[model samples]
Target: MDIKIIIDDKNIKTLTYDSPVLLSRVIRDSGCGFSFPCSGKGVCGKCRVRVTGCVSEADEREKKLTGENSAFRLACLTKATGDCELFLPDKNITALTDGLCSRYSHSPFGEGVGAAVDIGTTTVALYLYELENEKLLSVHSFANPQGIYGADVISRIEASLGEEKEKLRALISKGLEEGIAELCDKANINKEECKTAVVTGNAAMLSILLGEDVTGLSASPFTLADYFGKTVNINGMRTYIPRAISPFVGSDITCALISGSDIMKNEKLSLLVDIGTNGEMAIKKGDEIICCSCAAGPAFEGTGIRMGAPAREGAINRVWQERGKIKYSVIGDKAADGICGSALIDSLALFLSLKMTDETGLIKNPTVFEGQPAIEIADSGVYITQKDIRSAQLAKAAIRAGIDSLLNSCGAASEDLGRLILAGGFGSFISPENAEIIGLIPPGTAKRTVAVGNAAGMGASAILLSRQALEKSEITAKNAASLELATSDFFMKSYIDNMYFTKKD
Candidate 1:
């Protein structure tokens, strides 16, 4: 039977999909604005959808999630019986094209026109530059097409091992091609006019992009068959890829350090933490750099939370407590549709300060707030649930534990580093004060933290502009020491220790 879902919004037409599949899969296959935080495990309850058509009754997960008698159904748990009318969060749906950094200073390497692409797990940014004039010609941004598969690298690696790997690789390649074609068109040049393309990403991402097998990455002592950099010809353009440091810390981190090499020249000890599903961090002390990767999960990017969305329009990206009243700012200055990652941190801090939530992340459910384990962020009814709190706790704990592991390995404390550099989109948008309030970043590091927007993208640009920079990336990748978290007992201990909401006095 064909499944039909109708959005209750003006000018929005009904969506028809063939089914016998879970609604969550259909929603993602349809490329809608819906999210599945648990990757459709039915544990997060974030992929809720409403139906008025023929369908099986909600399952135990749905029933428990929605309080047994609720009208909405958990999309992952509910299977279709026949054609049905479905409703979506129309006003709150976000477009992925926004929140891209198109700004760049031309540092074109080689000669002629070229392009640099950063293939992030959640997003992709591309820049077209004229090497002759050192001018940045065009820029484009889009959501990583593979996001529908899952948010983190492991899900991606699993997807890459099965028959779906080809489909997955094609998705990213097509997105990159589209972005490249658009950049060429915007600059009024032909696709072949650009002679060079520099790409950077984590090992898994780069592996899939280059059509390499990912089975080795799934086991203990993760290994990459394609750790060595390669130059391939795509659409008549020579594409250059950098070597990965390890299976987890790929070339992107190398490029990030390269982009920030000037700052590191300050001759002070510092750390570069790239916040993403794969939280990659590097500790630099007098030319010696040690790095590690943590499975921070997708929670930080607004996945896995009910009423959570990406940093799209209407997403509550900011929240604060003003004289016992809660206030927030949305992504596009519209009404609160759903909370994004930044708002998640802000709400955690606010809840802790207001005593609405305890140190263990238990909601007090004060008499004034409907006696539910939730903190309402807006009058529009979008709120953070108890599971969302746990999700944040897990994500934050992984990062904090990763930091501690790095610190412990370096035999240093938080005060030893002169600067803590926060890179990537999530880190760039987050408020340091809120970050400090929740202990995501340790003490003394907050005031010295620098948010370097799109450091990986800038690093890719640097590679395109200078052969010396490209050479440095290779050397950096080879020299970088990757800490294996599995062998470290301290990581597990610190992970459990940091799981709760903590605020140092």
Candidate 2:
């Protein structure tokens, strides 16, 4: 039977299935984009789809989850019995392709054109450069098509261990190829002109793309199959992927460090935090750099929240309290549909200040939003529920705890840091003061905090344009030290302690 998946009434994808299967599995297998906040656990109820054809009737659990919207079924729980048409929400993700790039002399490997790619778990960015003059031609980005399997790396890794491995590889491979074509089209150049590329990403992404065995990444010890500091063929293009620092901390951080070299020169002890699904951080103490990664989850990226979203159109990105009234700014100047990470942090700060939420992250005076106890925005339908607060709390605690662990390992404190460079898309929009207020970052470090948006992409571009940058990336990857946080008692203790919002002195 054929299942037609319609996205926002315009984009459509049809998949053929033989037996009745879970709608979530069907969607996952179809490679269609859908937000599985809880990885299709059916607990979040965020994967709501309208089915018009043969489908299983909603059970008690599904009925309870769907509430009064009986017409809609949770994709995770519902089963597709026969040919059906599924109406899905539009996933117009806003990817961060631009970053703070430092200029370097042109010393590229070859002539013509080249592409530099940052393959983030959620988004992938490609930068095209003219190798002859080292001039940037165009930039392009898109949601990682592998997201249909799951939201986090763990989910993707599990999926890659099975028959769906090739599907996963092909999706990213095709996405990058299309992005390269798009860049060439916009730049008025032939595809043949782009002969070389540098692709940087986490270990799992790199491993999957290269079609390497990833069983080592599935369990403890988390052995990395390949360090990947060499050149290989990627869909017929000669691609160079940078080396990773650790199993969790991949080449993305290596590229970020390379891009931010100018910013870390003066600081004796500088810290870089790449806030994403994995809270990857690096502490450069003297000439040595030590790195670590914590499982921060996807809460910061708006996953697992009742009314959370990425920094996209209709998403709230900033929030502030003015004269006892909560004020917010939305992306695209549109009506608020959901609150993103930066706003979520700001809201927590504001909530704490107004005594709306206590130190334990409990809503003091919660109102009803979507039939659940939530803090609703006045006039706007967007709201944040208790679960959302917990999700944010876990993510923040993990990040902060990881920072503390890294600082402690170097016999240093937050005050000892001369610079705190925040990297990644979410890091760029966050208010340092608000982050401190919510205990997402250390106190009194806001003055030193600097957000360098998408440093990894910038570094990848540097590698594409300059050989020195590429050489530096290779050296940094070889020298950087990786720390295991799971065994650290300090990390475990600090994680629990950081869960409680610190009282502002």
Candidate 3:
């Protein structure tokens, strides 16, 4: 018999018998936005769903994480035995494309002028805009070449610790150069034609690009050589970097702050959370702006998890409730391969809400499923384990605690925030409600939140397009104060306390 499944309030076509596919796979194939961070290994537990008519066997791990509930099953673990309905949580549905890219329409330079570049730790993006009409001429993105060394900033930091520092720097520079060349090629323009360019990145990444020693920025005392605006020539492209607010906090954040200029100028309080391998935040309260960067790790970038992958094709990106059943969506409609970072965030929130995992980050009865062969022991070793959770907890805690510290420093409450801006590539994949449910962002902030896709890149482009915006970058970097979250006693204490999912009442 064909099995009918409904996802995200829509009835998907019935599946042919003998498919023997997992519920998660079915919904994902059906275009339901569901994320599986661990890539259906059943370890990350983001693909949870409720089923009726028939119940599926629960792996020891699923039972342990979620408890033995008749109504609930890990979508990745449950198999479709007959026609059924599933409900996807609202928090799991992530809109494919919001109007985030539209904000960069204004050309910084006059007509046919300027370029902006955002050198992300994982990806690099570039934009060309017409200065006169303030319209985007072209936009280009590519995987950062630094990714070959490691996926996250810390890994790159570690890679830079030894004699390979120069190599790491060259690798990143080469990637940027290639990205620039590609963008120029796509736009049918020459690199020199771009009158100006603005670059934004974390402190370590910026230091490496400029061929500066980054080791000092990684350890205690965490001192930075300089944070003021400086002009540098990269392949004849004149670039401006925002001043470093602190050792961990870099100029890219300054660019991000520049993009959210409206928030700073407004009377209302706002918080800007740029979620990445290392979560950087800036909270604006009245006239005061408090900023900090937490070493949130690379869990969101597909590193450290067994089945983790970048936000590429075959990766699950969103999830939701539909007609009493769980549904999910994957990038590019590819086969389920692995989960990316945003999916990891969603999975953690869902797992916590469903009581599959406790605040302590412990999975009660972790066991492999029969058909899910990925969970089997391999020659190298076991794949996903308790250690992965510990890593994720460390990452989540740093972000959560950082938010708490920033709020406290500004002498404001979560309710005081008038606007919350989420900036990053990974931020695009996350559901605001799931982020709130995981305690990653403040509860009410979700409603106030808007995802600004690659704001750093947009800000960099803004500077590239307009001389006025370029001058503003300098002023913004100078006035912006950076808080070193790693060295501060408050951040340290908060980090330690937030290591677990359950916060004290």
Candidate 4:
């Protein structure tokens, strides 16, 4: 039956067969940006859409999953049986980042075209920018295909240890190929026309993408095959990878160091923290910069957590007290779906402020509030379990520990730092107040903390667009002194001690 679904006052007509297709897929095909974390597994519950007119009974699974009134349905699980109107809530519509699509339009230096890539554990984002006017031409992003094997890099590393190594390589390669093709198509240019691509990712991701054995990276004597800058050809696309400082710390940090050049050059001591699955940190003391990395896991990126997701449409990204009431903003203003990285941080911070969560990373009282939906339940307890707190604790601990270790390595204290540069996707979404309350960053660092949105990607783009920038990146990578946090006794102790929401001054 053909049906007309009215979303946000716009009538969308489509033809359907017998059974219902996933409302998420339907909306996505209809040019609606609906985000589905967990890849529409009905686990995220972020694809909620309201149905008008007569509708079928809610399935037991969805009923138990959402707990919303009968009218609301998980778009991933729902099917269309008759003509009906669907309403996409404001919270479900993801707002596009300003200037992201225009950052790479014209080349500053003639005869130069470059691409910046942020090779994340769960998502890969690319920006095509022209060097001339620093105009962004197009932006492309997609779920990291490597996620099919497992959600985290550690899982992928373990899987690579088995016969699935080839599969891992193919997975990363396919995603890069697809992303490159999309960028080229959108920019109306040939692959060859793209003069260079600047790539940034963790050591494990880089190893996997290059088809290098990463067994050493997983265990002791952690050593990378190569850390120095290298240029490789992938399907005729010239790609430059910054010289990795260590096994766990790869070009991503090096790129950040380059993009945060101003901070690094400041005479005053500073700290740069790029929080992610692999937390990378850098501390500048006078003319020297010391760097370190810790395994923070993928808790913040929406893995490990039952209903967590990346910052996408329908994912809750911010939460605050609006006139003494809890209010939140979703990535896409469609509907209340799943919690993204930012939302998880906000939730933890809110819980802390409300005394619902203790300093020991314990949720004192776990209950779904009225009007809010419950997304997951397991033997580990209900939504936002103690286990989730522990997971987030580990993540925060690794990041904080890295910061502490870097400061100690530089023979300086947090107070000595004049500025803090927060880089990467985690940096962009993390609220200063929330970060400070959870102790992810030091107390006074937030005031000096400047969120450099996607510094790795921006740095990569800069390198691609200018030969001077590429040389600077190479120099930055070379100067970086890599500190292996796993081998440090202080780091281990700090990681354990900082695994709480308490202050560690």
User: Clash number for every model?
Assistant: 5, 0, 41, 35
| Candidate 1 Cα deviation (angstroms), residue 102 | 17
User: CA lDDT of each candidate?
Assistant: 0.78, 0.87, 0.67, 0.70
What order do you get sorting by lDDT, best first? 2, 1, 4, 3
Which lDDT tens digits does candidate 4 get at residues 1-505? 4555675687756645466655665564554334444456676555668876545677878887667465578877887666666777543222112211112223333355667787877667788876556667888877676654455667778878888787777767766777777888899888667766777788888888888888887678877777748888755667777677777767877777776444656789888787777777887777677888777877888776766766667667777666766677766556755567777888788878877777886666555532332322222222565666787888998888888888888888888878888777677768888888899888777787777767777667666666666677678777778787767898888888898788554
Summarize candidate 1's per-residue lDDT along 199-318 as a digit string, tens digits: 988888989988888888999868889885678865567888988898889888888888853335647778889888878998887878899999888887877777777788878888
Kindly list the per-residue Cα lDDT of model 3 for residues 350-434, writing each as its tens digit: 6666665677877555555333222211221223345666777888788988988888887778888888888877776688888
Candidate 3 displacement at residue 141 in angstroms: 1.3
Error of 4 at 390 (Å): 2.3
Judge candidate 2 against the unseen true structure and give its global Cα lDDT, from 0 to 1.
Answer: 0.87
Best by TM-score: 2
> Of the candidates numbered 1 and 3, which has the greater lDDT value?
1
- Global local distance difference test of model 4: 0.70
Worst 10 residues of 4 by lDDT: 93-102
lDDT of 1 at 232: 87
lDDT of 2 by residue, 1-505 (tens): 9988887786477888899988888777666756676678777666788888999888877877667657789999999999998888777785787787776677886678999999999888888998888788998888888877778999999989999899889989988888899999989999878899999999999999999999999999789888999999997888999989889999999999999544447457999999999999999988889999999999989888877788789999988877867888899968897888889999888888888999889999899765667898655788888878988999999999999999999999889989899998999999999999899999999998988888999998888888888898889999999889989899999998898888233
Worst 10 residues of 2 by lDDT: 259-268
Show the colliding residue pairs in model 2: none
| Model 1 segments more than 4 A misplaced | 1-37, 45-110, 261-263, 366-372, 378-380, 503-505
RMSD of each: 4.2, 2.1, 13.0, 7.3
TM-score of 4: 0.76
